[model samples]
Target: MGRNTRKRRTPLATKAIAASAALALGGGGLIWANFYASAHESNNNAWGNQTKAANAQVATISCPDIGQKLTSVPRQARTEVDGELGNLDRQITDAYQRLMTTRDAQARDASFVQNSILQPLKDRRKAIIDRIKLEINRVGGSAPGSLDTLASCTGTPANQTTAGGQQQQNGGQQQQNGGQQQQNGGQQQGNTGQQQGNGGQAGNGPVAADFVDITKVQPNVAAKPQKSGNASTGVFITRCGVNANKNHNTDNVIVAPGVTNGAHHLHDYVGNQKVNAFSSNQTFLQGGTSCQNKNDLSAYYWPVVRVQDGTQDFDQNADGGGKEGNVGKILTPVQAQIKYVGSPTSKVVAMPQFLRIITGDAKTTTNGLANANAHWSCTGFENKVQLTTQYPICPQGSNVVRTFAFQSCWDGQNIDSANHRTHVAFADANGNCQNGFKAIPQLTMRLVYQVTPPTVQNGVVKNAFAVDGFPEQLHKPATDHDDFISVTTGGLANKIANCINNGQRCA
Candidate 1:
């Protein structure tokens, strides 16, 4: 009405022109409007995408106390493009690798013979551990605990105490065998030998965590009594060595707490404070995600500890290429320079001269290079003073363990019958193997003086670290007992004859 009220008709060509003009005006307006609408819609889409990504940057790690749950300690947000995640991840991963090495050694020395079998395994395991630790350290807040660190710290334990006594005894039997794994950690253990390691899990004498001084502790022969007054010696004919078939023999030095069955990498030597660990050697039964099926070795299990005394023939192949062997020999000058920072026990004896071996032993094969990892490598483990702590703290949390133990096996030789050399070691004022006892199995055990009460402290669980090892054993032969009869040319023969004729076994 405002623009076109008249029905104006003119010549036919003129009228067509007017209609075309009107169509052009409406078409132009619609076209311009469409362009504006498209531009506005695109801007909305771009902003939506930006907002979504901002939200995706992180999800809070819930610490209800913090308005935003803290995944980390309130660090800046990281994104795939920024490479922040990878940076944080690398550090944590390195720590995991170091810890793996510590765990591997502890597992290797579960028993005396176990180390021989576990040496190679420990190497491979260390490599794997380094890689794993690297991954773990890179990521923040992994399975936080010391369980893994304490499990793998190797070498002879500082405190290997005895509940009964710390010594091995010989039976009067002629035929004997000695058992020792050179610490390569065997590729495979035969079923027959395996039965004795894991409790009734393996066989008759599962390796307990106790290695005794063969020369120090004597056996009760359990022979027929010759004396008028005396009770029988209780130790005679008790289980000697354990086997996978449940058979035991005193003919061999059974690796204490060796694998009649193995729990592998056991954590919580005392109880409660568990650190993070990585391995398949966790608990087979109920436990956390980190728990693995493994073989466990502890000073508490085998109270007897053996420090290497001397060597006439020690093959580098044995001792995990010095993984368990003492390769450091002080030069005459260097040793003289060592000053006693504190006093050693007056009861302590000096290390016998016979204990030293060739210094360059296992030089090439078992070098620490093979064990280098960011986590707990053997490199960080040493008998030296810590440069940082100035104490003997292993660099990694996995460096030293309170429950760590020494390894030993019976060479199946008679303690009474054979001429054998033995080495002994003990802890001084500080828990260290500085003091050597002048005896075979020439070592003194670090016994625990402080007993830890199993109570939660101040509503916070407190874990105690205690030194553990042997209480020493009686080193005497039976004077008079039924099994202490005089050895006659035919005394042994008569017992055999009686058993055979009676269809019974010898007592």
Candidate 2:
């Protein structure tokens, strides 16, 4: 679809703020409609009334991940197909906004959501899907007939039972469990009449239940695999300053190339300085670097974290910021550690130039946990526990941490894949590359932040922090992700592999 044909809808921030105010003024029927229920909630409901209420609390739209399903997009048609995928995302975002603002209508009629919001959204998606098929067929590639099946989306419930047995409320607040709250995995904590608060300043998410006291979580880190005699046991570290240059944008060049505001959320970038949706392989090769070693021109980026303290940033009214329901002050990480380590089972190979890797799923809240890989913890408790869904409430003097471990196995032939994932895979349990894949140096990133802990009192959260995400994702911690593009010179790539395979550490 052309830009001129796209309908201009009201910004989500404006609608969300207005809806929140209306709900605050005793509009009991109004609710934030995009909240995701916990995955465990479906199996643990015991109360009939609670279950009924949960069913009626239609919170989010769950649709098939078309990008994931297209594992065979032809190279000739990828650009057009990717644009259509981006359009599909925009359609969902608009539909989610309409659902959020029409709580009154939903309360009045049982089928209001299906008839007015979901059906229209499905029709739009079908058109986009058809366009994708046409693009593929034009390039002499066969498109799957099942592509049409992914057009329809269903409403997901709002309330879910946490692993600790506590229930989520219609407004995305944690319902107190008698006088105690359950932590993840059935752990119990005592607290009565405590409401975590409504989702952050945007009124969408990072609810109180989304945060847990890090001290209470048990140690769950797994032991590293033991190295064998022939295993590559070296490490290579890179000093890429934590986005100090303030290179931030909402464009995802690897996924939605040429589409402005393609990501719909702000990303803090380091390394290659001239990257955006329009950037090509040539642009990356010529871009300046943030790494201490100028030879490494790779780009590393992840969503920017924000503090919801009623403060507005430079993009307060912009498409990927407040307008998309990502509000508050953007935070720069206190420290960023980028390291690459050799495979545990075999000698490593140099990565192909321009290899693109995306770790973690940005839509995990709605897509489920198959691709979810967010690791959140506090400084002092690093080895004790890591969280995938909930944000950590760090203790005083202990900073918050976000970690990403990228895929280490490559197919040896393709630098990229249709879904951007099939080209690379994680090593198996035995640390061996599966199929015909080759082991490569694993990239691990650790980012630390100094943030004030948020508190929930009387159903209000103060100074809460959240990861930037798509508007419909509601800034859930589970949706946190990272992206990387390798633009290393052949010599530098060889040096990295030698450093690792030779069992030596280098920077």
Candidate 3:
């Protein structure tokens, strides 16, 4: 189910110095350690101790993503299927919480994690998967026979402690980018018995190793694809004031239409007023807009980024906030730039109304990195360097930046697919639409935040910031994502197409 074929840029070496001591549970019976070292560590005496501490296990549960495995669910069964999918997510979250809280039991008995936690989780998941199959069959749709096999889950180590300046391969390319290596300086022992102030208030993530100083990273951005003479080179800009209305929610209308708190993380919304899990196509058509142009009522939203400085937001006690391991003071974007550009190979066509598109993978930490699309950088270093796995530490007078370039090719018929991704695709590396798809206006979003750079001192991070995500995901940057639903009228859609095809920049 890997949609995007574009090669990912290699991550810069982290330079932040961090170290965490191993925790001893009850008379030193069981030891769990989560430790990291700086890339610049050259001391022979200290290297041996740090390397042994890094080998201690810090594990989390990993389950198959059921939604990605399904390619077809009947329209009549979609509502029930989506709800069941949300249930699966909730089950995992609950299991992860149990795994974090039951370290004492795990230390006492070797089989505690498997017997008390993972097995029960698998049984619950099997029941849910069976229910999903019945719903699909009830509507006369064929469910995949492999659905039964996806019910079993496994324990996987979460912490990855790499040697300082070690080289890694990405997409068959060798990268040797140099920079100040920032190790995760926070006290992040994933299963360490403590609850608060361990990497984050939720005791999961945003460790110091998750950030890289942007000034030290070498330039690694590739050149843009070349445009032919027939390319639509014009641009269209939309001004939707950056979530000033304070519209925030955890429901995703496109993925889990009828389920509340479906996203499991809070999203900052703009451009549409009437948006919720119950919203329909008609609701979007009749809703007011935040854009200056009244005719454009598109809905644009992304996961809110937060500073983990012990400040609690209103939702800190709610389902998708502190309760789900997403805690901190929410930081509103200083600027949100929404733009539409044309294809490099052909003229663009109008997008269908209510066409739903999602850019990044929300479960990428466990799902692997085939569909991860988030890019992070600083203001002036945008053209020089971009990071996919780590957050950027911007210099003074500069702000943090997040960029998302969505899929630009449409399948020409369905507004959405069962997987919510097969209906649209990214163009090939040469910028041509394949498989009978048509080129549409490419939507790109840029969000800027004025954040005080976090610092690591005495193996603890101060003012640590992270993107909101599922409890198990640990707020990794690769899990950052955005959602959009097109609500343009026919006239406005036609105007946008004409402007791009005629090579005229319009606003």
The candidate scoring highest on TM-score is: 3
Q: Write the per-residue lDDT of candidate 2 for residues 370-450, one digit (tens) a residue.
A: 565678889988776677656788989999999988888888988877777888887765677777889988999999999
Better of 2 and 3 by lDDT: 3
lDDT of 1 by residue, 21-47 (tens): 122212101000111112223211121
lDDT minimum window of 10 residues, candidate 1: 475-484
TM-score of each: 0.15, 0.83, 0.85
Q: Model 3, range 1-507, lDDT digits (tens) per residue?
A: 434233232232111111001010111011123333244533122212223223223345678999987778998999999999989998998998887777556545546666788899999999999999999999999899999999987755433221111233556443322212223333543232222223566777755555667776667675677999999998999898899779999998888888899898999988988888899999998889999988899999999999877678899889999889888889999999998999999999999888999988888667755566778889998888777666788999999999998889998988988888888988876788878889999999999999998765544556778899988777767788899999987488878888998999999
Top-down TM-score ranking: 3, 2, 1
Q: Which stretches of candidate 2 lie over 4 Å from their true place?
A: 1-56, 160-197, 458-460
Q: List where candidate 3 sits over 4 angstroms from the true fold.
A: 1-57, 160-167, 170-198, 457-459
The TM-score obtained by model 2 is 0.83
Candidate 1 lDDT score relative to the true structure = 0.18
Q: Is candidate 1 or candidate 2 better by TM-score?
A: 2
lDDT values, one for every candidate: 0.18, 0.73, 0.73
